[model samples]
Target: MTDLILCGCGGKMGAAVRELASAREDCRIVAGVDLACQNSGLHFPVYRALSEVNEAADCIIDFSHPSTLPSILNYCRTHPGTSAILCTTGYSEEQTADIRDAAEELPLFYSRNMSLGINLLIELAKKAEAVLGDAFDVEILEMHHNQKVDAPSGTALMIADAVNEVRENNMKYAYDRHSQRKKREKNEIGMHSVRGGTIVGEHQIIFAGRHEMITLSHSAQSKELFASGAVNAALFMKGKGPGLYSMSDLI
Candidate 1:
């Protein structure tokens, strides 16, 4: 059985993971790290700081804010054999680099979206990019709950990156176009974000050609899809060597 420590235990995603892991026989939550660790309702010990936890876990599942990255990375650095699954989004470029560096010390899994369907979308996007090429203009649109702070949800970027990787000329992401009064650039990938109501998540990729278009979309009905994906990733990552992994790796 994989011993797990859950970061951001008080949040919705964290709580979902906690509930699901508790039901599974392959893993058990040994402890949790969260600043607001009041009445967590979990049987495991909960601590405000990672340093306060004395028990060692095989892996840590972090659905916390990007601000907590440093502490998580430090925990992995100090602990020789622990692995981690980072499900948080909106990380700066530097923070992403830190994750890559930390991966050299211990196994680390990172994904913008944990839903298996979304990861499949990423692969489909890559295949579409290769087949469509520069004959089509790519546009990515994403919508999330109003409470979400990040624009162009990380999943949108993940899809865009997949498309860009297979393109002859790498596409540049354009988030805003109000100021520019020019025709659409051939190598530009337009990214649009919508925030309203209680949207769980939705991402659509449009490939516009001369007279035809292809649209690929994925709509999340519940947060459990992501939560369960994280649990699966945590289980898959147990006892792995020092390296960075993604949903693609798990699949």
Candidate 2:
């Protein structure tokens, strides 16, 4: 079994990851680092910082906020032998570059969305864009809980970017719907967001044509799905080459 360390082991996603991690047979939770003590009744001791976890491990899984990057990258770079799964999202261009730099020598599976279902949808969306051609208009709608800080969720922009890569060069992200004198552009992908309820996450990609509309959606009601995917990624990254990877690699 591979020893695993979990960063952000107190948040909603962390609790979910722990619940799922407890049932796994391949990975062992050796260390847990979090800022909060609400660990959702985990068996292992959850630390308030990474330095408290004194032993080295095979891999580390991060589900914390983007602010956790500096220490994490530093940890990975210095630990040389340790690998990481970056499940945290919402990054600035500079921070992303820093992550890429860290992944230069260590194995990293960095992704905004880790659920296998969402990844499959991405593959399907790419195909739809290619087969449907320029006749269909692409629109992405995403919803998260009220506390989520990022608008249009990272996954939403990821899907829009996927479609845009195949659709056209004039693709633009439209966050609101206020204009009455405007029409949908064939090449532009409209992105929208909603914040309410305790929704775990929901994303829908629509291909609207003249006579028909095709919609593909992925609805997540709990973080268990994300936890499972993250664990799978941890398993997949073992013995893998040094480079940044996504869900596309596993799917």
Measured against the true structure, the TM-scores of the candidates, in listed sequence, are 0.96, 0.91
- Provide the lDDT at 2 for model 1: 91
Indicate which candidate wins on lDDT.
1
Candidate 1, residues 88-140, lDDT tens digits: the string is 99999999999998888778999999999999988888888888889999999
Candidate 2 on 26-67: residue-level lDDT in tens?
Answer: 987888898877555677777887767787777889998888
The lDDT, on a scale of 0 to 1, for candidate 2 is 0.84
Question: How does model 1 score by TM-score?
Answer: 0.96
Residue 145 deviation, candidate 1, in Å? 0.5
Weakest lDDT window of 10 consecutive positions for candidate 2: 179-188
Taking every candidate in turn, the Cα RMSD to the unseen true structure, in Å, is 1.2, 2.1
lDDT of 1 at 1: 93
Q: In model 1, how large is the Cα lDDT of residue 166? A: 87
Off by over 4 Å in 1: none
| CA lDDT, candidate 2, residue 58 | 75
